[model samples]
Target: MDIKVLGPGCPKCHETERLVKEVVAELSVDASVDKITDLMKIAGYGVFGTPAVVVDGEVKSVGKIPKKEEIKTWIEG
Candidate 1:
């Protein structure tokens, strides 16, 4: 699984990144978690919001912080 957390290094962005990493580690999922802090790169994903979560190139969540269960569902999907 490929997980990308997009933000411009805001507090929520950092929290989202930490949450994703925590969930991945807890579940032992074989995934690469990357943080996209570049504005151009984030926009390239067609996400107009900060603190977005992209799983496997799909925009799972955008503009707000998602719940842990929501993230797990996306990863497990």
Candidate 2:
């Protein structure tokens, strides 16, 4: 699976990335997580908010930190 954490390298963005990593590790799922800091790239995903989580090209969450259980569901689903 391919996941992208989109933000401008803010604290919330970092936290999102960390949560994604933790979920990936706990689930033992093979996935690639990329932090997207470019405005153009982030806009390309149609996400206008920071700390957005994209899983397999789909927007999963935006603007806030998501729970680990919710993240796990996104990864496994």
Q: Which residue pairs come into collision in candidate 2?
A: none
Q: Which lDDT tens digits does candidate 1 get at residues 1-77?
A: 99999999999999999999999998999999999998999999998788999999999988888899998899889
C-alpha lDDT score of every prediction, in listed order: 0.93, 0.93
Q: Among all windows of ten consecutive residues in candidate 1, which has the lowest summed lDDT?
A: 41-50
TM-score between candidate 2 and the true structure: 0.96
Measured over all alpha carbons after superposition, the RMSD of each candidate to the real structure, in angstroms, is 0.6, 0.6
lDDT score for residue 29 of model 1: 91
TM-score of each: 0.96, 0.96
Per-residue error (Å), model 2, residue 20: 0.2
